[model samples]
Target: MNFSTELIFALATILLIPIYYYFTKLRRIEKFFENFPNPPTVPILGNARDFRSGPAFFKSIHEYTRKYGNMVHIKIGPIGHVLLASDYKFLEFLLSHNKLLTKSINLKFLEPWIGTGLVTANGGPKWKTHRRLITPAFHFKILEQFVDIFESAGNILIQKLSKESGEKSVDIYPYVTRCTLDVICETAMGTKVDVQNSETSLYFHSVKEMCRIFLARTTSILKRYDSIFRFTKDYEIQKKSVEVLHGYTKSVINSKRKELEETRKEGNYSDVDDLGRKKKKVFLDLILEATVDGQSLSDEEIREEVDTFMFGGHDTTATATSFILYCLGQNKDVQDKVLEEQEQIFGGEKCPKVTYTNLQEMKYLENVIKEGLRLYSPVPLFGRRIDQDVEYDGKIIPNGVGVIVFSHGIHMNPEYYPNPEKFDPSRFDNVEGKQPFAFIPFSAGPRNCIGQKYAMLEIKCLLSKIVRNFELSPAFPRHEMILAPETVLKSLNGVKIGIKSR
Candidate 1:
């Protein structure tokens, strides 16, 4: 009996020993930050134990900023974090001097889906080559052509709203997302999206799944059992959906190629869009002409660039525009002010007919858009990987750690604006020489969003059309949905709002 008991005890000890060793291996990274500005951490998991939301995360960071200064450090589950820009000195130092310090490496998962497109993949020849090639495609001339796309989409949308007139407040989320997707499809690929078709909605489903997978991969607890969970069922499905998206795009390229080939045989292939120019019509057309400092995009590279455009172009704008309209609903005075601005610009009776000239003339409407961006910047935290090791505020932040810049934190900092919480566009008016890098809704530096001009034009055009068709106000409690999440932006809740056509 004694012999048998001893053998069983030995087996138990053997199993427990490996478990202890495995845990230690997992936590090997925690001890190096003994002197840094570490936030209160719990054992075994560190700060993950206490990371709550509903303003708690932002408020905790604000406390850390007060206690440890703006350049403090914290561990987000074995990952080191720098601060959101709370002061000009450190902000300039991190952004300007330490260009190498800021990058987007932890966004590793997105590379497969987004494929080293501007937002996801970082440094090396890949980004530089793609950026150089794709940059000019968004030049002002190309951007201007998209205005009609936005206008026509807006007109169609207002027609739908006119149908919804006098009904109880309706949720605008689906409508807004559909409209943005329609516009992006037209502008980026020149396809007439049959949005009523289920196949067309597959892109949105894949995008939503990818966002979920990103959240899963980033959290530390989920990272454990990584070997077993590496290929999640949902992840596999998402990957398959991406394959579908690629196949669809390949078909587009093949069709275009077939046309060119046939034209070559019979001899007439270079006529342009209806404007009498001698280039092909949409983003794909321009990209075919782009050269990366004299290197043209490869066929596969063109596919990747188009995928990037679809990923970047659609969802974020839909969320932002929906929330902006939601905010307009929530604040009567602000809405009235915007209405007055629209009246001055478009003449009150004809707000739906906003020409490019009138869009430029709507200054106060511009400020309203600016304030909405400030209040709810589409992407809350954009991750960048270090290009090289660099110094910042007397510390050596070694290269390869993720640089997670919280745009939301920077946007809401009270120090930069006198009253950051208040929605005031006049802050922009009075602050001329404030700073070039302060308000980065689309981010800054050479790698900022390529579609800022196109995005602004679309948003302004759509909002002008919306204001004409609907006097928006919340059906739910006013403040209930000032912030809700639909991937990158804080989409509004209830989405429930009244509509009245002019």
Candidate 2:
């Protein structure tokens, strides 16, 4: 062959490889979804167009579920096939079982910010080890100790809002976010970022920017490709955000280590309380003391886990608490009931702080929180990569495809939650009879949120304090509130409410 012909043939062969693979993969996906009910997919792009508006995509999925039933498969582009399962039984099986333990590929977007921490780590021995080592940090006893921190933070929030009390209206999300940030930083890293007051702190800005970038990446089709995304401004912002975040975490870790060393050198390795039990350690301290396979976690590993908790612990809880406040603002009846419940606990006491015992007696308030989470889940969707082929309702879901467990859909399912749109906390009165996976605000099964109990305690503490100090009125009517899905469910226009001192 001529030299030019030879070169042309080599290039043709190289191009044909991907083309052939693409067709074969497309055919396989078609065959796989042939038996399943799926929304109409266009050639090559599949359902990519459906997600052009990233935040609106969840609403689209909800509409699709309503039209097409619960277990609907979707394809995004040539390679991606997603199964969005909102069926209660399907979720119970998927989340509770060990076979499908790995997180979905979509979580890869968070690795740049959180790394392979518990939130994004894949299933296997490494994840198992991490889970075991970190679980102790959230033990009931440890969480009980955190109540003081929650109270302190809640007090700060109340004091901050006191200035705005009886003002026309305020967007409460930023205040709640700052308060949660303070609580999580103090609890997780044993350091205080004081983000509630220091609004422009590098740590606070880094976390906010990181979450914004993470959500933006998850919603953008073009941004999913690292080669293209890295050159963009979002990617650069993400990198800088990570730098600030890691720098902060590293400093906290070093400071704690130094403190530990000083204690050890002074022959005061442990301290005991009056009850004779060793003093509880913070999350970072426990992780530092942990040994996986007989070796301690490296600084990067510890930082990843700390960052994961900081992100998970604060953001989701803040979103949930904000929405809970919004729900109360809109539903005066519900708000009245919650305040009545709080009054019953405090009994006209002046400036009563939320004790651990106080949190337990607030059953009515707890139910309200649950109902609010049901309507607006903090983490709306749980995505998993199916590790093995699984059969559900006698249909086979092929292995290697992604499964998105839509918590919002499940929460809104009329069958599970009657009058789903109404803010009725009574549904939780007999929650024991509900389906196992029906109310998964913190998710379900083995990978369920470890900090869930802590989150609940924190929310109750803050909400109790807020309701006691202010009469919350909706800035906009119930129907006017618009929600957008980001790292967590957020108000597109901010959660605005008018607070009058009680």
Candidate 3:
């Protein structure tokens, strides 16, 4: 045969080998889960077409859960099969294990942005070390110090809102997001990044653009491949965002290190209270001070953790806070109840700040926040890679498969939460009585969000202040607000609310 014919034959043989193996693999998967319910799949693509981005993707998953009964299997091209477990028991089985600690390959896309920080790190020695080293940064006393920052940021937010009170429909999202960004920056890195009031900031824009690109890439099968994605405009934006965000973190890390060195050299490191702890050790300071197994973290490692916190600490909290406000706006009676609770705490006190003690007193407000999180979880989905075969309800999820925990669906499970669609805060009144993994807004098990308490404190501080200072009403009807999950759950239309000064 001629050279051209030989090349064509070689290419055909190469293509046929994978095609044959793909069919063989598909047949085996089908036989393994023959008893289970699966959404229909087509040749090569499988159920890839069913998984779209944002609200539609979530809506489709919910529909599948309703029809397929929680544990549904889906296949996406050459990436392999994903078993979505919306059932609480399955989630418990998946999350409670030490071996299944590695995030799914799907989340590998986030490595470019978050690196192998605590949030995205696989469950291994490195993750254990990072978790152990970083846990002290969120000590109760440390968080208590952060309460002041929360109050300061909350005050700034209230002041900013007061200017627009009763003037027009204000989109509370941007304001709350900026405020949270400020709080995280100050508390996490000891840097004052006032992106909230700035008309334009490279760091702020980069973070926002990165989120948009991240979400787009995560949801699109076509964009999942690095070879294809790198050529796209989204990749360009993502690259710039990483540069800006990482550069910002590096600068802050360097500045903080210099200050620490200066303090040590000046013999001012003696600045400690009776507890023998530094008077002020922000998250970065703690990381710098930390030694895991007698070795301190390098500058790059410090930056990774800082960037992880900078992204996770701010964005998720901001989205949750904004949604909570939107939920309160939709339910005026609930808003009144929250305000009443705030009144009971602050009682005719002008310019009251949310003290740590005050946070404890606002029990009802806490439930309100919990209920909001249940209805609108900031993180709708959690993905995990199945390292070994997982058996659930007599079905075998073979090794190397991807498992997705649909947090939103779990929160909405009728079996767990009666009248799951209702906005009743009383559901959380007896939280202990409910299933352990049913309402995982901050997730469950070992890998649960470490900053959850901090998030709650910050949210309570901000919401208590805002509800006290303004009467919030939804600018649009409750039913009209479309929920979309882009990294965090958000309203497709901005969270617009009418704010009247109280």
Clashing pairs in 1: 103-384, 103-385, 104-384, 104-385, 105-385
- Compared with the true structure, what per-residue lDDT tens digits does model 3 show for residues 1-502? 9999999999999999978966756555656655558898888888877766567777888999999998887777744677788877778888787777888676677788888988888898888999999988887888888888888888888889989887578888889999999999999888888876786878889988877877777877679899999999998888889998888889988988898899889877565866996587789988998898898899988988988898888888988898889888888999999988877878976477666888889999999999999998999887887667667677776666667889999889888888998899988888775588898888888899988998998998888888888888877444367777777888888888888998
Write down the RMSD of all candidates, one decimal each: 5.6, 2.5, 3.0
lDDT pick, better of 1 and 3? 3
User: What does candidate 1's lDDT look like per residue over 301-320, in tens digits?
Assistant: 88888878888887778777
Which parts of model 1 are misplaced by more than 4 Å?
Answer: 1-36, 52-69, 78-85, 97-102, 196-200, 223-226, 260-280, 349-353, 477-479, 482-486, 491-494
Clashes of each: 5, 0, 0
Tens-digit lDDT track for model 2 on 60-147?
Answer: 8988899898888888887777888898888888898886798878788889878898989888877899998888778877887788
**lDDT comparison, 2 vs 3, better candidate:** 2
Which structure among the candidates has the greatest TM-score?
Answer: 2
Write out the backbone clash pairs for model 3. Answer: none
Superior by lDDT: candidate 1 or candidate 2: 2
Cand. 3 TM to true fold: 0.92
- Candidate closer to the true structure by TM-score (higher is better), 2 or 3: 2
Candidate 1 TM-score versus the reference:
0.84
State the C-alpha lDDT per candidate: 0.68, 0.85, 0.84
